[model samples]
Target: MSKAKKSEFRPNDYVVYPAHGVGQIVSIEKQEVAGFELELFVISFEKDKMTLRVPTNRATEIGMRGLSSPDVVSQAMKTLKGKAKVKRAMWSRRAQEYEQKINSGDLIAIAEVVRDLHRSDDQREQSYSERQLYEAALERLTREMAAVAGGDEITAAKQLDEVLLSRAA
Candidate 1:
């Protein structure tokens, strides 16, 4: 690191990267690239088993953010319980939109994807693509919920499923 506490983020901070889900700032490191010293935030995604090095200067610009507040999380849960909004667009278009929402790293938008794509026990079966997208959104949402509310992702996922199930019935 160029200096201690050089950026808004610090070691051990859980942050959300737009393309990825929740990750922790493992450390700030300085690496030499093309004769220039670059200070980077080393973010570790435990669920994905991946590590990404983001330049501290561009972290905010790249949509790296702290966890959503409790109010925001509550809103996401409420969204999950709301009616599914399936647009009239073709499957390809809808899939693209859902993919964007999952990658955008906005909690509510991600929740919307999960809600819209969810299927109850009696609902029609989903195509492979639809199932993939639905799982992606649920994974992201659960991870964030776990990070914010203090529990494992499995518990958070179960809670979210209950919310969706009640609405579906």
Candidate 2:
């Protein structure tokens, strides 16, 4: 791999880790391993209370990126407003796709998962796994939305819920 681009991330910058949602860069450290010097970015996932160390050289390769632009977030919100498109496929197959979308770290894809999985007050209830995936997708979307919107997670979540609820109505 060509040497990773110079670290564009700094301490306190919010970044998205494809599999983990949003995290804050806590620090950059240099370590010596196997006679090679390596630089790593230490990131903290507040909601999960988990810390991750990613090699600075591999950050881009791993899909680590900055928060979405406001335009992207707006597009994601619009996605939530679109009609749900549940496939005729088996639930297990759909669930797997939803999981992949949530972990892809793409705002619009996560929005699609939220759109498809959301159940209205008058609609039939979701199965246990459906509800789990729905919550997971929602949480991931909101975390990135919060980072981009300059608000806390709760407010961002409420905004997302409001958008989805309006569509449901």
TM-score of 1: 0.95
Spell out the clash pairs found in candidate 2. Answer: none
Q: For candidate 2, write residues 111-135 as lDDT tens digits.
A: 9999999998899989999999999
In angstroms, the error of model 2 at 110 is: 0.3
- TM-score, every prediction: 0.95, 0.95
| Worst 10 contiguous positions by lDDT, candidate 1 | 1-10
Candidate 1 runs further than 4 Å off: 1-6
lDDT of each: 0.92, 0.92
Report the C-alpha lDDT of model 1 over 1-169, residue by residue, as the tens digit: 2432455789999999999999999999999999999999999998789999999888888888889999999999999988899999999999999999999999999999999999988989999999999989999999999999878988998899889888988
Error of 1 at 134 (Å): 0.2
Q: Model 2, residue 37: what's the lDDT?
A: 94
